[model samples]
Target: MLTMNDLKIDTVIVLDGEPFVVQTTQHVQMGRGGAILRTKLKNLISGNVLEKTFKSGDKIELAELSRTKANFLYKEGVNFHFMDNQSFEQFILSQDQIGEISNYVKDESDVEILNFKERPLAVNLPPKVDLKVTSAPPGVRGNTARGNVTKPAVLETGHTVQVPLFVEVGDLVRINTETGEYVERA
Candidate 1:
């Protein structure tokens, strides 16, 4: 159990019989009225986002989310497989549950799986991942002065990300998993 005052960003809570994670929260106090907590929450299972306000001290249900480190194995049809590094147990998650992290994860990559009441809800990749560029066009000479120019490059994981024009095949690059953006050359 939790109260509106205890709401924190990224904290999972149960509302209306569904699990939601707080994306952002602000507690506001007015001189003429009572305090309220404004929150932006995302549905853990459906991936829907909603903004709602609650009176301060209002009771809320805390969701039981468990996170475990797992090593990604492979994909079978519509499900992705992962092995628990500690228990040697395996689990398969649906593509929708993986959300954005699916784009940055590669085979044998370490990931964090978020489970709600023992059911997998989401997958979290490392903050940054190093991957090799498997395909990209050559950059024209004298393009260095271009401002933040990028070219689409396919990674070893079969995911495509925009990399600097200077990037080429076989080059190793670091990518921000959360934003699915190129960070820098590895």
Candidate 2:
């Protein structure tokens, strides 16, 4: 059990029989009333978001969450597979559970999988990923003066991201996985 005062971003807690991950949390104190906690939470299994407020002393159930580093193996249709580095055991996850992280993950890439009561709920990718540009328009030499214009580029993994205009096919670039934005030329 945990109290609202102890809530932190990324903490997993059970509410109304559903596991929710804390997305954002803030402590608030009313001028004439007691303290409260304002939080934005995301449902682990359903991907639904909710805004909630709790009194500072309110008690909440702490979810049974486990995290492990795993190597992504492959994807078969709607299921993505991963191998646990420690146990060498493999687990398969549904696309909905992985959410947007699936878009930036490459085969055999290292990732952290979060499980709630032994059920996979989320996938965490590294902050930055290096990928090759599979397709991009040829860069015009005089385009440099335009100050960092961007063009859509397809990656080897089939993810499309906006890259600087100077980028071209076969060029390697670093991408911010969280935002799916181009970070820099690699």
Poorest 10 consecutive residues of model 2 by lDDT?
139-148
RMSD of 1: 2.7
Candidate 1: Cα lDDT at 53: 95
Query: Over the stretch 25-127, how does candidate 1's per-residue lDDT look in tens digits?
Result: 9888979989999999998888789998999668999998789898999988768999988899998888877867777788998889888887778887778
Name the runs in model 2 displaced over 4 angstroms.
Answer: 26-31
| Error at 135, model 1, angstroms | 0.8
Model 2 Cα lDDT, one tens digit per residue, 1-186: 898778999888999988998999989889998999999999988889999998977899999878989999998998999998988999888887887778888888899988887777789888998989999987676777877577789998888999888888999999998888999998
Model 2 quality (TM-score): 0.82
TM-scores for all candidates: the values are 0.81, 0.82
**lDDT value for candidate 1?**
0.87
* lDDT for residue 75 in candidate 2, whole number 0-100: 89
- Candidate 2 Cα deviation (angstroms), residue 171: 2.2
Clash count of each predicted structure: 0, 0
